[model samples]
Target chain A: MEEESQIPKGRYAADISSINEAHARIKSLILKTPVLSSTSLNAISGRQLYFKCESFQKGGAFKFRGACNAVFSLNDEDASKGVITHSSGNHAAALALAAKLRGIPAYIVIPKNAPTCKIENVKRYGGQVIWSEANMRSREETANKVWQETGAIFIHPYNDGRILSGQGTISLELLEQAPQLDTLVVPISGGGLISGVALAAKSINPAIRILAAEPKGADDAAQFKAAGRIITLPETNTIADGLRAFLGDFTWPVVRDLVDDIITVEDSEIVKAMQLCYEILKIVVEPSGAIGLAAVLSESFQKNPAWKDCKHIGIVVSGGNVDMAVLWDSLNK
Target chain B: MEEESQIPKGRYAADISSINEAHARIKSLILKTPVLSSTSLNAISGRQLYFKCESFQKGGAFKFRGACNAVFSLNDEDASKGVITHSSGNHAAALALAAKLRGIPAYIVIPKNAPTCKIENVKRYGGQVIWSEANMRSREETANKVWQETGAIFIHPYNDGRILSGQGTISLELLEQAPQLDTLVVPISGGGLISGVALAAKSINPAIRILAAEPKGADDAAQFKAAGRIITLPETNTIADGLRAFLGDFTWPVVRDLVDDIITVEDSEIVKAMQLCYEILKIVVEPSGAIGLAAVLSESFQKNPAWKDCKHIGIVVSGGNVDMAVLWDSLNK
Candidate 1:
């Protein structure tokens, strides 16, 4: 990885400076979510852990940080024309609220099969939802058409610098809350959150171990890191819908250079971890948010002897806007 | 009411000073749980609300506050001999953990039909569980026999002054977190939590309106408040097992004198409220805890013109140690 970094071909990856700018821009718009210690998870994982509870954030997900930053960073003229994006749920709701706050129209292209609760949330936030077929091509085409027709600014969910910076705010809060933290475990989807967190953590304390967790079904980041290149999946399958994307060009280098390791967890393990979070922590965590804890509890990283020396760990609980029916089925299983 | 207070016999009632003393004594042992603001509930109820999340306390309920105070207040010889109590679930777990912390044996007499999860928690905390028939007489007889044989200190779950004072710690924390709160709502079960909260809130700010929430199916507290005397229920038939007891003599006066009003919510309303808590707040609030929100959301209290002036309202989320299966069922319904 260091050898690859020596090459001058890759774009200058995200750094603490970019994250700091993003934090300053989005601070007033987004909540400073708390870092809560989980005694039960600590006892089970044998690692003193702090959970960055982004589930308590507005729109019940950390996506709001990125959405707000992306929308707010837009030029006055561009923002007046409004913004358009494609998402299953969280990003749409986040963008809607962020745009609404700026008195700008938000056009969200969502898959026809998106959960009702999320769709309702987007509409409640005054976003215009344009339904697309349950496929990425349809979603992209719909969003592009909306952008072209309405002349609205296109906000890529994870590929944009502002999004990564906004996501990095989680690390800023975590490091401030627990300065002694030696390791950070963040769930990776398109590498946006982890990329930002890695940059922030490494910048503050270069010795900090930045780990990435991903569902096995959506393990594109792990494969990408292993191949030393960006990898896209032909198809995605996971209960953690928020973590189903492949890494973008912008996100790849930041994750590649900053993150120490990427670990994958089975969907069953993710569900079981979610159950434990609901039972013991009394907090509802979507499947993606539970993956980091799942990896630690399953001892996936224990093979690395350096992990044994880790004194303090922080895990980002990415989101909690889950459908109750789906949660009920998962709990029963 | 003021004239009644002037009577010599009624003047000796427990007040805020006693509640404050109890709070001071237990402040070190109990958790100062967070006060979570709800956007969804606020919009629905049209009231600025803060949830005093006692559900996050150690032992997963407010019962721990009372249990810890009761157990620790015991004399050294009595503490060494251990403590025994009879409860359906929350009280048993609370007493077990509190006693375990003191390195003393805890004998808990639970009904045969107690949830397996609660029983497991009791054993996990090193408490000895003695099964009794699922009735008041059988539980009392079983606890008495164990106490007589072992010379264990008997810690009454709700009827004791020490227990009531211990529960008052929640009010102290709540007011400290949100001192500007104009109204405080709490669920009533044998009037322990509400009694403590009422006394503490009255002591802190006499103008703060203290409201009691009770399930319609088990409205013993409501009846007691209306009749100006304790009213025993013919049968308890609510999912809120934590709020199914009759008001005790010590608690009755507090409810009548300190509590401004008593409101009732239906079982279905409680289930709906729990679903909302899980879906919106992402917190696992037990049915008992949900009842206070249920009263506010269902307009049971809102219809009262006096409540319209309440600028800041505080609700005590008393417990969260609910069975996953039960939560699943409630969410599905």
Candidate 2:
């Protein structure tokens, strides 16, 4: 049961207690997002689905919970120097806003080729933009240079104990909100979210089932789980811009050992799920956010005998930072 | 203080007690929709706004409240025959669902020109659809014919006392959810929603202010308020299809004596609010539902001396039954 030995020394520190501590630490700093359901959706899926609407969380995503916890966990000396991160996604904006609340500067290393809206989001939150080339190597180099120059703490988006523990708080809230939940469907990217979720949920209710949803175009997590090792892809293709990252050392072991299964879905299925969220649930969800719903409604999940008795399902709706113009254009095509 | 006498005898009968009874009668049948708020929206509007999200109600609108109340209030003899209504909007679908739940028939007289989606909604709810000309006269005649054929009781969308009383339940829930609310901004259509809101809110707290929002394209409510009488427009226009109807005898007295003011907004403003709801609030609201937010953010309300101190406000988001294909087409154009 003790998986701590599997992780490298002085790394992968989060556990159920740490997650509970994270909840206590950041309780006042984040919004307790609502759990929503639709009767019509229930009929279609042949199960009662409770949607944990993290889309309504501050910064328009659940990223704020982790970022806020990570920023606040710093020592006085580290806090005085502010924080730094490399992300062209929700984490960049979340970290910026979190730092702003704590009255500290945030250095955000975003690729130059990143969308204008994302760049604007970081700037709107008072984050100092540090442009890098359009690749992970350039982004890390730029962030490292900023950390060297400013002595600012480097906050990993999801591959850190502090970050994942904060993300784990969602599981505690989810279980409390719907105690009858027998299964949790979460979208897998870098595995920070599901790592935290699996730890917290399994610790709380040992009988609970954890399923990971992955984009078929970027099924690195599914491959890693099957191969019993991490598999980093040189190229990834998917409309889910948020779910392209490979699992880190901190997240891989938890995902590999704890996840019940990984379900990969096509881009078209994600689009259909997004439309359903918009039309039936009356809630907007980015492609990545819609993955959990897509997984729940997928043919594999519906027909699989293992998941036949999983009647009460909880879906983590992770984010809603979509570009409407781009989404509608793609949808029209 | 009694306004019941203003209505013709044997016509309007709902009061605060009747509204309370309606709440008890239909409480088990409908969802208690959430009251949502946004910090950025509050900062932009310079007031704390609580959105009473009736869009999450049954049948995707607050019409279910009134329809359910009316359907359930019938005696065994009257209820066995079923119910009838003439609507091509949220009310039609709401009535159909309400009747279906009671194990009775629902005869929905819809205009021939009604959108395919709306027609589909009624049919999906097991309503028997009767087609008539697009005009109200023909629709009414068709509904009358259906009523005579089946001996079914007629359920008006909003004009009836029972319907308004059922709608008043929103005020009770909203006030309890946000006790600090000093003003209620409601979208005015046939005046049922606002009239019920005003009566209940004022009864609960005499100092509470009630403001009605009307689309300038179909600004009959504003005109009637200014002229001190009902002013029916021969040809009404507005993208907010739900707000085109005039106030009825049962609702006029409530609006005339209880409502503080009626604010008319441009279709452009309503569209902007709809976009804001989609982008910022992550909620889909029809044009009529968005009008309350539009009115609150309007320059007239922002600059008005009378409402300057009205800080804690509640906006009724009336519905979310939108045709996204049509909406996207118009937006693209």
Candidate 3:
């Protein structure tokens, strides 16, 4: 870990140098996920769309990149206590797998209503799951209790400087993979992914533009951006269960100032994008993962003349931890 | 086209040299599909598995490789007449896309019962679809009539030397991607893919083993191998719609002499493999595409003591052109 004096002074913990450090630190630990493109999709979107397939990342999401970096960044003495996180999604599985690889224990506080597939992933990665009520307060409280009892380090899913720095490594590889990309359209939830990606991409090429895609049902990012302040939603509802969370403090500043736009898409549009991903791209992407494509294909983005310069666009497919049983049920109906 | 005298004298038209030529010819036209590996899958199979993701290939299948090669291999005069093929599968769409790219018309003879998704694919790629009775005899007759009327050259899906040679390019890339692979488990339909892969892989590494994976309902290849002769099934029924066709004369000799073994898997096993592909690899693979993985995970392969030396294995995920509507209907039931 870097000394406290050396830590970058910013609204967020991560800076370009720290992200670069995270990239170097986790280079061998994570997969250099491929950037895929479809000619048909490109033709339809009228833009050269490149997909950074984080769906193929370890633990089936880009979360592994951040989790691995955070786990490895810990000092030998600090790491002995293991790690803890409150997540019912990709982050839980990612941290578990990362800790397992580092030969450290991971205590995961998962909601009782969490998908079975996610629970299976955590168990498969040797995570000790502590069940919690399907509410943020209960989940966080349980995580706090576990942290105090086990002396385990609390690893925030997206609100940590180290975690965001690790996630930023995606742009390091993405730009190297396709440097011609003038714009990056990323799905935003807790804003960690977009924050990291924007910081790294802008640091490398200040001319590059970043657009945050959000589901209309959970359009807190768009609301926050419009209001110029954090706007917490009373409730959230969207098929993209992963994107229901609002922006965290560590992620908000980066998303607010650095990210150029927040494009909200309807659930129907997201479903269409998911279908296109299945039929054309031949990749299984959860609803949240498909939002970037949905945002680009949405009428607002296509009709907006201000963003016509985005010829070469990079869309980050954030994750692929979809519950097929639930998806089939919904599709069947 | 190569002179008749220059063509190799063998049961099949393609040889190591022709396959090499095909690779060179299609190098710029086709995609260099990626080889992906899952650590969890490798752990489960107890072997280092490298997946040649031809699902990511153009036309969502490996057929594009051969189709592109065959279209480009034509002389200017012959190419002027355009190309024709009798099929309602990946070949029709692949040929259509290849022809479109080559600035030629593709006349595709499709059975009326063909899936709507396939028909849409042909139309999307500008292939002129000539509907035929849902039988081989009627389809072939219709194709012959169209050939005579339009003066178009017939491009066999897998039986032709050029098509097989084009398919052989997969092994060239696969071997280059993973040279340590001691064995290749390839899904067999008309034996075109495995024949081409076998010829190319064995030519490069004489000791490399080739295993042909077949659906149990369409186990003509397995029966033929056991009988030491061609054994055509009067009727074939398989969830793997692509693997229902038996071996062609052009592909039979190669399968008989070059392929080391044929492993037949049940539909249930293939479905399980497909689920694993969606849930774990996050890739959409049709039943035929998942057969290679199913063969690897089958009881026969797992329990067999004779094949213990196989460590590094390459599984060719053949295609990803599934009809989601039909899939959902079946899964719902």
Candidate 4:
């Protein structure tokens, strides 16, 4: 993995600057969530782990940051045309809220199988919903049909430069909140959050090791890293529905180069970590949000030499939107 | 309910100064927990609500603050003698942790029927535990026997002057965190936390309204207010186990004088509030921690003329240590 070659001879020199601008842009519209630590967690891990709590952000996730930035970055003419997206999770609600913040309309295409609460979350933020069959083809077709009819810009969940740049701001704030961290452990989905954070951290401090945690069930990112090429899973499966998506074109190069390690954990491990987070941190973190901590406690990771030297670790708790059924199961178990 | 009469004019002249000193004394040992807000909660209550999250406090409760202050305020001779308390809840764990920080022994007397997790919490902090029958007479006799044998100073869970003064530090931090709060809602156990907070808030602004929230089943504090004198309950009952204790001698004066209202909520309402706090706020608040919010939503409180004028409210989330069986029941039901 060539670090500098990933950028194709440095055409993205302004990525950090864009992230700084995103921080300023969304400062008023979104929450700058707090960084939290637990002595109990630290003792168990035998490392100083700081949790950057994006769970407290509006819409209960860090996606709101990028969604706001993307909506606000549009020019007057494009802004008036509004935006559209196909999602049934945090992104839909995020884009809906972002559109509302910008005083623009948002068209959301949701799968019929999406939870009622999630759909209501989008509607609560004033998103116009269009339902489709539970498949990628139908979702995209419905979204594209809406986009063509309304002439609205389609906001990709994670692939866009602006969205990743907005997500990069999390690392910037984290570094300022707790300086001199030797490592960062981030959960990888389409690599939006981790890619943005890795680029920002590497630009500022080349020695800061950026590690990616992924579910073994839906581990395309880890497979791609090992094979040195992108590979899409035929069928994805994980309790962490948010981490099922594969890496996108825009996020691949940055993650392949800047990410120091890509480790995978079993679904059972992820659920266990989720329970630990709920019990010790007393916060309702979805399975996806607990993956980073799961990787920290994984047998493979603990046996690695890097674990010995990495003293101060920053773990990004990406989101906190858990379905009540799943949460009840986890708690009642 | 004369404010100045409670203090006896000549005694306790610099109450706020003592709180400030407590803040200084235990600054490093305790967390200055975050103040959180939820748009959904505000919309439901029709008021600007800020939650002072002491559930995020060390030992899973705000009791740690007072416990630390009591342990550290000791002279060397007194410190060497150690400290003791009879509690099977957050206060016992808080005292144990506080004593551990000051490098002193802590003797804890617990009922034989106490939950295993709570007993573990005390032991985890290096406290020596003695088990007794589940009754006030047995609990007190066992505690006194331990005190007589070890010469350990007895720290009342909420009644002692130093402990209440230490609890007062919460209001100091809360006011700074959220200034101009028209109403302060606090849960009453033995009235240690509320009395301290009320006194501190009143001293700063005489017009600030201090309100008490109590469980209907364990409404001794409310009964005391109605009768214009203290009256002990024959038997206490509530889902909010942390709020089951009767009001103490020192707390009665401060609460009776400074507190404006004492509202009670049914256990069902407390559980409903607990679930809401857990789901919407994404925080695991025990029933006791959620009582204040329950009071604000109560029919009696909602119909009050004073409620119409109060625009900004601060609710103190007192603790987060709930029995898993109880929590599971709360969630499952």
Candidate 5:
């Protein structure tokens, strides 16, 4: 909690120094995934594209960075008590692996509707699972109950200073890898990845344009950007399971202030982008991870007057935790 | 024919100097693909695994290296006459793209039974197609007819000196990337890739063990390794379409002296390995490309006591021109 006081207020909510510290802190724990580009993909979009493949990150996503920071930042006393989070995605696996590295317990609250494979992944990583009914309210209530009983730290998926700052470390690596990048396209779910990247990239080079790619079904972030208010979808129907969640409190501010624009893409575009990734780049990109490229190829993005000069683009492939059922459905449908 | 004088003769037929020249010639043309690794894959095999991802290579395979060398090595007179080859796979696309880079026309003789997608790829790269009946004899006849009619220089897929030297350049990149590698795994089709890699790797470090992976159905190389002579299979059947070709004369001598062993894996094993590659490594590995990793996981390889000491291993992912029909069928079957 003492670290909370050190967090900056207003425009500079996340410290660039804190991101640097997080990079050093989790240096040995995570992989610095390769920045890949393709000749065919570049030719199609008429842009020099660079893909930061975080799908190859530890725990199959960039969540490992933030999760590791949360787990390792805890003092011995807090670490002894352990940490808890309600997640059915890469975050659960990330937190589990991160806690296991520190020899601490990780409590994961997974909804009953989550796939059996995801639950098994959390268990395999040494997480204690508490099952709840399928719904946000149920998931939060169960997680709250666990916290009340054990006094474990609640590691939010996106809405935490430590978590957001840790995820921001990606930009530090990306900027160094491709210093000439003019625009960066990121897929936004609960907005942790984009928030972290935007803050770090802007601090490094304020001229760099930060854009968010969102699924049309879950275009809360896009709607928020245009209307200057949050818009929660009653239901999300996109094939990108990882992008279903809306923006969180801690992430929304960074995204709103630092991010240049939000571009929405349909599920068809995501599948097409994924097909290109496999066909051209020889990489398996889950739907959410593929959205960055989807946005780049979209009519809205390509025709945007503001983005015409964005010849050098960086795309963030956020995760590779593929929901196979969704993939089959998307492909067939 | 004057260029043929530069090719060394005797037991050590392919000169190291020739490979060095090829490396210098194609340095700017080809990509130095990264050697990737996985923690979970390493844990499963109990060895540090490094993957040379030629799947990400231009034209989606390592064949581009050889083709680029052959196309670029031609003198102005030869270049003006253009080039021709008989291939219905990655080689045609590779050769077509390579010739296009040098402003020379590439003629491809494809069997009538070849897939429409493959023909489209050749055309996409500006290859002029001459159809032949579905057999090796017809393919050769068509290519010879085209060559005689047009005086186009013939580029043998695996047998040529320049191509082998160009393919060997991968070894220079891999060895420089991971100097401590104790074993190198390569998937064998016509043996061009393995022969080049073995020669280059051994030249860099004599102690490095070079092993070949082959499909059981198309196991000419593996059979040759065991029998001390080439045993061309009368009929080949395998899901690894790129690995169906028999060994060529120029590559066999290099393979016989340099390669340590050949490991054969089943189509089932190749598919499972591909699934693991996509699930764990987040990379799309075609059936042919995944065979190297599959060999390491094979029962015989695991039981062999001689291989116990081999800790750090490098696996060449040969190509990523995946057959989607094959992939879908494999998954469903």
Candidate 6:
């Protein structure tokens, strides 16, 4: 665990006002994804569970909401040169599509090891791809080099204020659909999704518990929160590629302060949740998107006192862009 | 070919008016399922196509629309005693749920060989199940016995006018959503769905070409249309379990008169279409549900002069409640 004093000052500074403004700005541009009741999950947990299906969102993920908000929020002068971002998959495809909609060029720095399907998705959406080595340093260096050369603004995948504010729209929509939610369980990677959701949800009803569901293999958020400071994992590994990020500087403090708990679930739990979603719900949820349900189904959550009497629970199903081959392998395992 | 003079009277008597009334009666009960465009299929076919996703409907098939309509069309006295139907799968589950919603008891007659998953679905939705031999005679006899014992109204799976009307709702919704649709392709089983869809679509716009898609293995509808009479095969054999039915008395005439052509797709084509739906559309579709798409994608339709200049095409994707084990094996094949 890292020291508490190492925490950043501005990370937890976001409030409801900014999130509301973000909602207003991006509401027209993004899809108001449906919030569906999970009868099976609810029955199993003995709790009324509502899933905010961001998996059905444009670009097949919640990242589009943030990417769109960020790209559109930029001023005319800043937008002309376009935006640059580094992502292994979802974020790059999302940012590319969002930028294209705004008639702006997008420079996406992708790792060489990125999935072929994701790479094809990025290219299909008209994003310029700049391939880089599969390492944080190489990705950062490539993004910076592109930004410096082309005067394009660097859109950090999770650390950006605009991105967080955009992602907050999901909570706003969820609360609107299911106003009686007692708790919100969100999967945390760089904490962008949870930070935005927590800020918006907590601001609306501070009593609503905000919990983070993390993969046990990628438990940076859990470690960071326990240490009361940001703690970057030296290496990350998980089937849930979307939730394998080391906690971002801007997101760690927000997650540390606002999120009530960080629950970790095994990769197998995620696989099981994915199977359930596919078989019972008839919805294609990627492994990362199933993390919240996995966490709830995990023994840890069943034993947690906070979940004992929760009347209404809201879970964000973040994305559904999964490779069929990988999914088949995971299910067989 | 069978002689035209030998055709059954009921098979030649159906028209568009009955289908219209059915659509109006059941409009409130059934969902206007979304029509989604598949970028992958469009690229492959070089023809702009839209999939009417009945797979997302209640009970996981368009069968629910017909089932609900048929159940609710019952008189107050008949409804009070409850309803009974014989189906190996989708229809049983659909009728069970629809009857449950209307506060009526539902009796399902299933073959002992029916998939366990489907049997559980009927029970899950509050239907009493009665097992019968895996043959049409046993199923009908069991249903009749249940009706006789309980005074329950018998809702024929596909033979009744009310059921046909209910299935016609899909065409009504599809035409309303895509007004420019030049051609409509629908799968044929006992011909209830196609008969209804043809009536609704042709009535609304006589210029629109209506086609029936059938599996080659269970090409009873195709044979009937070709013969200008109803024809029952010696034995039914097909992977498209839903399409393995002889045209019913009420449905035969509606399809024979209204449907311009009956296109037969191979079982392999249906499997491939199902796989494409799962992989590209991110929706689970049973082999039978994909027959319409298979017809459009197969060599028969692709090389047809009628399809050469077609701008808009609509294919009814009937259901998604597939046995995952069967799907896994089929996918491997």
Candidate 2 clashes between residue pairs 3 or more apart in a chain or in different chains: none
RMSD of 3: 3.7
Model 2: per-residue Cα lDDT over A9-88, one tens digit each: 34355788788889999999899999999988999999999999999988888999899999888877889999999998
Scored by lDDT, the top model is 3
Q: What is the C-alpha lDDT of each candidate?
A: 0.83, 0.88, 0.90, 0.85, 0.85, 0.82
For model 1, what is the alpha-carbon lDDT of residue A131? 92
Off by over 4 Å in 5: A1-13, A115-117, A323-333, B1-9, B115-117, B325-333
Alpha-carbon TM-score of each model against the true structure: 0.94, 0.94, 0.95, 0.93, 0.94, 0.83
Q: What are the per-residue Cα lDDT tens digits for candidate 5 across A157-222?
A: 888878877899999999999999999999999988888888778777778999999999998998
DockQ of 3: 0.49
Q: Is candidate 5 or candidate 6 better by DockQ?
A: 5
- Tell me model 2's lDDT, rounded to 2 decimals: 0.88
- Which number leads on TM-score? 3
Residue range B1-333, candidate 1, lDDT tens digits: 542243223332345555667677777777789899876678888889999988888878899998988888888998999999999878899999999989999999999988776787788788999999999999999999999999999988887888877888787788888889999989998888887777666766768898888998889878877787865559978878788888878888778877888889888788888878887787988788788899887676878887889779998898887777644444323
Question: Model 5 scores what on Cα lDDT?
Answer: 0.85
Task: List the pairs of residues colliding in candidate 6.
Answer: B11-B253
Compute DockQ for each candidate against the true complex: 0.47, 0.43, 0.49, 0.37, 0.44, 0.22
Please give the clash total of every predicted structure, in order: 0, 0, 0, 0, 0, 1
Model 1 residue A152 CA deviation in Å: 1.0
Query: Which stretches of model 2 miss by more than 4 angstroms?
Result: A1-12, A113-117, A326-333, B1-12, B326-333
Q: How would you class the docking of model 1?
A: acceptable
Across B199-300, the per-residue lDDT of candidate 4 in tens digits comes to 778777677899999999999999999988897567888878888899877788777777899999998888778767866788877779999999998998
